[model samples]
Target: MGRIIAIANQKGGVGKTTTAINLSACLAEAGKKVLTIDLDPQGNTTSGLGIDKDELENTVYELMLDECSIKESMKKTDIENLTIIPANVNLAGAEIELLDVKEKEYVLKNSVDYIQDDFDFIIIDCPPSLNMLTINSMTTANTILVPIQCEYYALEGLSQLMHTIHLVQERLNPNLEMEGVVFTMYDARTNLSTQVVENVKNNLDTTIYQTIIPRNIRLAEAPSHGLPITLYDSKSAGAESYRDLAREVINRKDV
Candidate 1:
């Protein structure tokens, strides 16, 4: 079975989608078959991966509502081994619509179950909220990867995130686990960044990746150009850090 990891943080602008796009791309570059699902209605992941989310006819919204098959929603990215099930603004309404569906929490898990065997890893980009879409993703995923920015208020809302995860494990998906935490937007010259890392390390009992994604213009620019950092600027620090993070993700062994 493939590992299903959801790149999630209830807080937005914390590099959640950035990690989702880059990590999946890097893993695919390493010759692993990877599938990414854009559960966020904003569809940044879809556009970040070079897909035209606005033009898509089939998306996760359709899949969630049983209007389309998973295969029908899957789209190939510029990256060879990476496939994505794109989503668009239409998915924004899924929250209210899901209330009427039977076994709604399992819709994502059930769709993913049939196709999990075809890939080595499945990555999900969740909306930056604790909504029904996130609930579906938590139920579908084997683990959750959180990205924390190295700035003030870094540790805020984390307790709630952890508590939500705990509830998911207890009530919805008992097999779910924390994949790890990754620090993003780090600046070596700033003591505040260093202090934030130390603060989180001292407080949280979770695995933290060593590769810190420094704030790079290349990373920010790549999404606008419809490419991943690896393709847009392979030699840049952002690309290298994501590659290192991918290796770490594949090598990590749970204790």
Candidate 2:
């Protein structure tokens, strides 16, 4: 079975979607079958891989709401071994609609359970909030990959995120574990970036991946062109960093 990982952070502009898109592409480049689930309503992950939202009939929303099967929602991306469960703006309503439903928190988990063995990795791009959708992503994932931006408030809101993870571990998914905290949008020339990295390393219990994703124009521009960094500019620094990230993730000790 594939390892189900949720790329999550409550704070926006943390490079969550960028990490999701590029890492999946790199993993597929290494010959691993990767399935990316775009759980965020923004649909950035969907468009990042060249999926048009207007052309979709079913999406992660339908799968989570149990209106459609997960297999039915899967779509091939431009990358050979990478597939995506695209999300659209309609997912914004899922949080409220799923609230009154039975096993509301496990909706995503249950939906993914049937198709766990289909890929080598299932990476979920979670919404930038600690809402029911994020909870569902946590419950569905075996491990959570947090992408922390190297900024002054890098650790801000992390306590709340950890608390939610603890609650989920205690009462929902006992097998759930933190994969690691990845440093994203790093500027090597800045002292503040160094300070944030030092603080994060000193505090977090999880392993910090050696590959730090530097802030690059290519990384930011790739999504606009509906492509991963690897496809957008294979020779770029952004592409190399994501490839290294994919290698680190694949080599890490499984929980």
Give all candidate RMSDs, comma-separated: 0.8, 0.8
TM-score of each: 0.99, 0.98
Runs of candidate 2 exceeding 4 Å displacement: none
Q: Candidate 1, 80: how far from true, in Å?
A: 0.5
Write one digit per residue (lDDT tens) for candidate 1, span 58-137.
Answer: 99999999999999989999899999999999999999999989999999999999999999999999999999999999
Poorest 10 consecutive residues by lDDT, candidate 2: 246-255
The lDDT per prediction is 0.94, 0.93
Question: Candidate 2: lDDT of 254?
Answer: 61
TM-score, cand. 2: 0.98
- Clash counts for all predictions: 0, 0
Alpha-carbon error at 225 in model 2, in Å? 0.5
- Please give the TM-score that candidate 1 achieves against the real structure: 0.99
